[model samples]
Target: MPAHVPDLTALTLLVAVARTTSLAEAARELDLSVQAASARIRSVERRLGAPVLQRGRQGRRSSRLTARGALLVEWAGPVLDAARDLDAAVTALRPPQPDADPVVLAVAPTVAEHLLPGWLVHLRAGPGGEVALLGGDATLDDPAGDPAGAVRDGAAAVGVVETGTALAGLHATTVATDDLVLVVSPGHPWAGGPGVDAAELAATPQITRRPGGGARGALADALAEAVPGVAPAAPVCELATDAAVRAAVRADAGPAVLPRLAVAADLATGALTEVAVHGLQTRREFRAVWPEGTSLRGTARDLLRIATGGRLR
Candidate 1:
């Protein structure tokens, strides 16, 4: 016998083979393919240092259990029975159904306005109570409205943020990605022109989000990396939200870097034009973050699953 006993799966497969007297039938009963079942038995035999089944010279048709295999099957019966009992006990101890607690979601403005609404629609179509939504500019200058901060402070059960900053003390997973584009009104001088380079963009005064917002920070970082030793010029106008900044840009306030999702409609409708910025990359990730040391249960986990298209658990 192996020092460590074979796992439950191997033992169960052996028992199935003995009961059915056909390896192929045993695999079908266990929902395993024939090849997988064969490999599993081979693994068990290697661990036991003996053959479990004797195959006829013809093929799998005349296979039979070896004497050692018969003995293992007998010993494995009690173990499998005990495992079933343990499973029943554990199932009884668990809650009968999923928890139905109210879920609160704190979301960044861009994600809330652009991506989260559709996610919420799908979430609401299923089993859940009213989900309190807190959406705003989660900037360093404004912690009160910071989505990640809300999760860290226990004010919200989950948060969605789009930023390059590492969220300390929270478990974060990427759900989607977005790019920021420089946009100007169709009537602006730079509109429909051959895009500007990073240095030119860095030196130009334009409408921007108020200092410390995620989009502003992303643009600044990209510009700094593209043009070393250079900082972005002061904004001609600084606004607190992407919507306000977009409105300003639409009114010919000046060129502003904004999320593509936020401007896709306006660009499609000819209300705004996207200006290409050469040598400047502004792609950012959208993340679902929750407090560390706490597993997401109930509706919170459901919402995350929806946001990630059922990928995360």
Candidate 2:
């Protein structure tokens, strides 16, 4: 033993894996790669001088915790619970500001990482004036859960999501557009070609986001309509983050459907080439949503105005 406390983050990961019973699922929830998760677990085990988990078969399923691992989870649970309580207590002790509402926005990982920073800068520079921006991740299968649901349930003042259809009980304003493009490394066969047809695209294995994601849904809907009998090829790799998908495509893993915003730099630098797919509609609208019938006021209204470029839909 090193005579020091275990890392809080490592302990949290252990609990996540123990509950999910799958290393990949835990990694996805924690926004980590499987390799990274494995490393963290290994480090924790090394510190304890005991194996905490039994590895599972590759490409099949998640690993299970050892009896000692279960014991670690039991010890960690109360520490985590106390930490949460401390956080809440600290938040409750903060003085309330009369001028600012501290607007919290929930958004998907792609927008949060790539698009929201610019928007935040613009909003702060505009008439909103010293607005406090609190951001939350609402990526698919996120440990914190869905962004749209967060807004709908009033946990957040607004949510920016990628969708073509309106969510029930919410007022959706189309704030921006993201075009999903089929991309490949510059050396891949699809590069500089006339592009693939619907059937050909359907039959090609590609890197992709996990199912149930906004991008995945848009792709599925477009493919189902355009090529009735054909289904998309099995994913060569499925990841929770667009960055991972882009990285895979850049490494020549396979052709991937990725947001233009995500691959813009790569396309500009000629590191990746965009391929057109005939008869496929790849554009998905990014909408700012809030509970319907609730009138926007104060900072919330100002944020909505800023997000939609002075237009509210």
Candidate 3:
């Protein structure tokens, strides 16, 4: 380790002086004041203990490289070329940065509550990059607060929702599956016996989620397919959240259909009973969605990957 190695600026200034044949001209080309460029040369000479320039007869304005300066210029050529190469390599190797603004994630209630926490934890611990996420309810962008609509409208960069239906104007992929089960308090009559028929279930007034919710929409679609021309019976109660619906059902409000993920513990502990529904398909898909034309990258892509359990799509 030498005490005073000439820096890149000094070396570059020397090369420029060699090419321009005048210290003032080289300084001008490099956007440095003549005094500053002269100081750089002096600094280099002090470090190297050698003269690197020859002053011409023209009032010390014109310059020429000394024997040592000519050798230095030749040596500095490769070093300078390598420096340029190193700079370009560094620029090429650098990763493209994600948008500075936090990526907005709109999520449906069930997925947001039951699944998002773990996914976000994984995202934080994983290798992708910084996860600057702003999480919100699926309704963030749309007046209706529909996750699909929020994504399509560009209100959110990504969305996680539970649904079995196709979303127009958006690209979606299944991340998980949930069964919408008909559940009641342990004391309800449906808790003990034979499965209810699809038609009978459709006609029974039950506690349910609000119309726009995923479970409610999925249940409606399934019932419509199972019993065509007969609309579902109006709800005895319409709740805004899964917890509310579950609490109401636990208190014997009415039998309500809900995602099993929301009530699995209650079902296992016999706090609630899952009544069978004959001829009805309650299986629904939980999906990650984004606007059709856009490609997910950076943290957005990383979140999608984690949600899909490490599968990159």
Candidate 4:
């Protein structure tokens, strides 16, 4: 091994660029200026003797990782994981700080926004008192496809994900159930009317969550089974958060299929109306997950108990 190794800071920046596919965006995240990010990237490329990013056209779009960059990112993932673990291990050796916050949770957008606030209140008022929630993306920004990954990577003590099956490396306990409802603005024709035909609903383009989201995946699977060989139109717009999708639908961008819990307030306020789909089943399971074989203790155990209503699976 060379005495001079590539700086982890630069490697971290590379991974950020790969995930975001934008030099400026990655730089912003790393708290570095664009010029500094570019310089760091060039330095890394020189060290590796290969370009890591394919810059997009100026003023047009963002840059993306090249094939070599993808490989570099793959190599960097484990390095970063190890670094995080090392930091955690060191932190664990310190004396416990009485004022340290409660266990962190990683949760889906719907759970974070609609369910957690009330749940936390209940938890605090009960056996688990005055618990603090951290890292659930409560603002509905930067939603994670697998919140359980946060638990697996030790970033969170537990995760609440909307899925029937347990994610690999985690044990899941069913906590709640949610239905995905087709919603439209009050002025839309579907509002206060008979249910939409399954075929028509499948054919219509609507505002939706980005691909690979649990809600989007559930809807896609239902449509596939309901109308085989018929594909739904591409979404009118794909938003990352339920809140964003709701906003788009409220603006009359198009009808949307969303978790009922996410739009409960809007439905009550008449800001949105549910349009039943005759033959589509939109119900989904919500589960609390923790890393397999790990015994829950203290706040984590208390949280799981509260989330599952004292039912353990």
Candidate 5:
């Protein structure tokens, strides 16, 4: 609250600990030792005259945040978000170098489809920066559960995930998000009109996203809840790529569940349509996943700003 206050560093460290819910995670994120992070928190709390967080159990989980701490988090989050945006804007105007490390972006194929094309074009033409982008097999259940050495082995600088489970060892920042839709071929009656219930959609032919992949089974899982043990039936074809799935639908493939962003172009062109599922559309989250050992770089930050498509929640 003081104008001349130093050590926003400690404040951020405390914030990181609260966000990550573990001292080890906070230390890894802050590039500090667990012991050192613990000491810093202790020192700050002593000075503040109140504990900021309660260590749950033997300290593996943080059980609570004091009222004062809650107020700080609420106040600080938006400020930090804005500050990061300002930093990104400045980075965008700078001329890039030939020798700069290529920004590695791991993304979901659907996001890579619409946003990536335009975003990359903007980056190269505008930033004139060298960069490399990567995508995982969406057919694969979860990238986090992939080869332990994969992030290290691939030397991946960042990973993008589409789920609720928090990926350990990465600084996760959210980007674009969309509702999951039940996709149908142009010829399908439901494709032309209003949304249908989950039960009806389940009974009809369904082209599920690859089983176990990101949010592929979300609708089916929801369906199973209402009618125990009833999984949404699969369509004749099981395509992996977003573009391919749209093409399949155009060719009269079964209705598929896809992120609205993934099928925006198709729907606009009348190539594919969504039949409403009774329940609410699945809320899908798209996040930028970065390795903890590496902090955010100026260029990467700019890329993120542009990639957000001017959308952030």
Candidate 6:
């Protein structure tokens, strides 16, 4: 090791930059100017032989852990965490304090795409707080996909996991519900359906959502009860994004069953149509999940209380 090894402050800044991905975002979270925060990171990287971040691209600084840099981050994260853990333990020995880790809520594609904006606008406007999010539309914003698990593991303070299939053993509260309606392109005859029937769905080149999947489950449940031997054939397209499914339906690829919340504006503007099913009106509830034994106070609880209308116990 060199005589001038990086100091603890430099190491902490590096870890923060690594966790946040962007220098500007890290600065915002840490309450520093982008330039000053970045300078600290560069100073640390300069002590190492390789670059730890690629700076000044697209007006944003993105990090790249070089081969040696990767080795250093891997070795350093636990060491830094342990030191902090020791400090926290010592602090805990003295007194109890607020435990808000600044929650990151994970939602399904439809919820994130459609429902999140209003909730987020509410979170930002009212909570004397800020929230950093990972994942949008089911793609991992962070390398680890389970943001709710992050709460359980203490990486995040809270998160919301959306699933039609039950998530057992977590403290969960139901939040809202939306319909999973059969969607078709504006040009389809079912677009102005007097009423869609099981036979009509059977004859069409349908785009069925798979069972146990978020938006798909409602449709799958309806079909299971309506047609005794109906097994959904392979979809013309399989997609994880509501935008993709909506686009596919618009391109006349096939009928897609999706949340009404996701396509509400489209349905109102006549960009798409919800086919009226004679015997099916599929729906599902959205549940807010937190780790077992999680406690809330002040801003986190206030935002949750506002979102759920004060029912969270």
Q: How many pairs in model 5 have backbone atoms within 3 A of each other, for residues 3 or more apart or on separate chains, i.e. clashes?
A: 4
TM-score of 4: 0.59
Q: Return the clash pairs for model 2, or none.
A: none
The local distance difference test score of each candidate is 0.79, 0.75, 0.77, 0.77, 0.62, 0.64
After superposing candidate 2 on the true structure, give the runs of residues whose Cα lies further than 4 Å from its correct spot.
Answer: 1-101, 127-146
TM-score of 5: 0.55
Candidate that beats the other on lDDT, 4 or 5, i.e. the better one: 4
Give TM per candidate: 0.60, 0.61, 0.60, 0.59, 0.55, 0.56
Model 6 C-alpha lDDT per residue in residues 1-313, reported as the tens digit of each score: 5654676666766666667766677777767787888787777777885677764657454665446655666768766754554443233223223574444555544555565555555555466455445543333322325645766676555566555566655677766777777788889867775867775675556654333344665566677777657775667766656777788888888888778887876788788888787776476777666667656766667657766876686
Error of 6 at 129 (Å): 2.3
In terms of lDDT, model 1 sits at: 0.79
What tens-digit string does per-residue lDDT give for candidate 5 at 267-308? 887777767666654776777766666766656766676767
Prediction RMSDs, each to the true structure: 18.9, 15.8, 22.5, 16.8, 18.8, 14.8
Clashing pairs in 6: none
Select the stronger candidate by lDDT from 2 and 5: 2
What is the lDDT, from 0 to 100, of the residue 9 in candidate 5? 64
lDDT of 6 at 15: 67
Superposed by TM-score, candidate 6 places the C-alpha of residue 266 at a distance from the truth, in angstroms, of: 1.1
Which pairs clash in the backbone of model 4? none
Q: Write the per-residue lDDT of candidate 1 for residues 151-206, one digit (tens) a residue.
A: 98888899988766788999988888999999999999889899999999999998
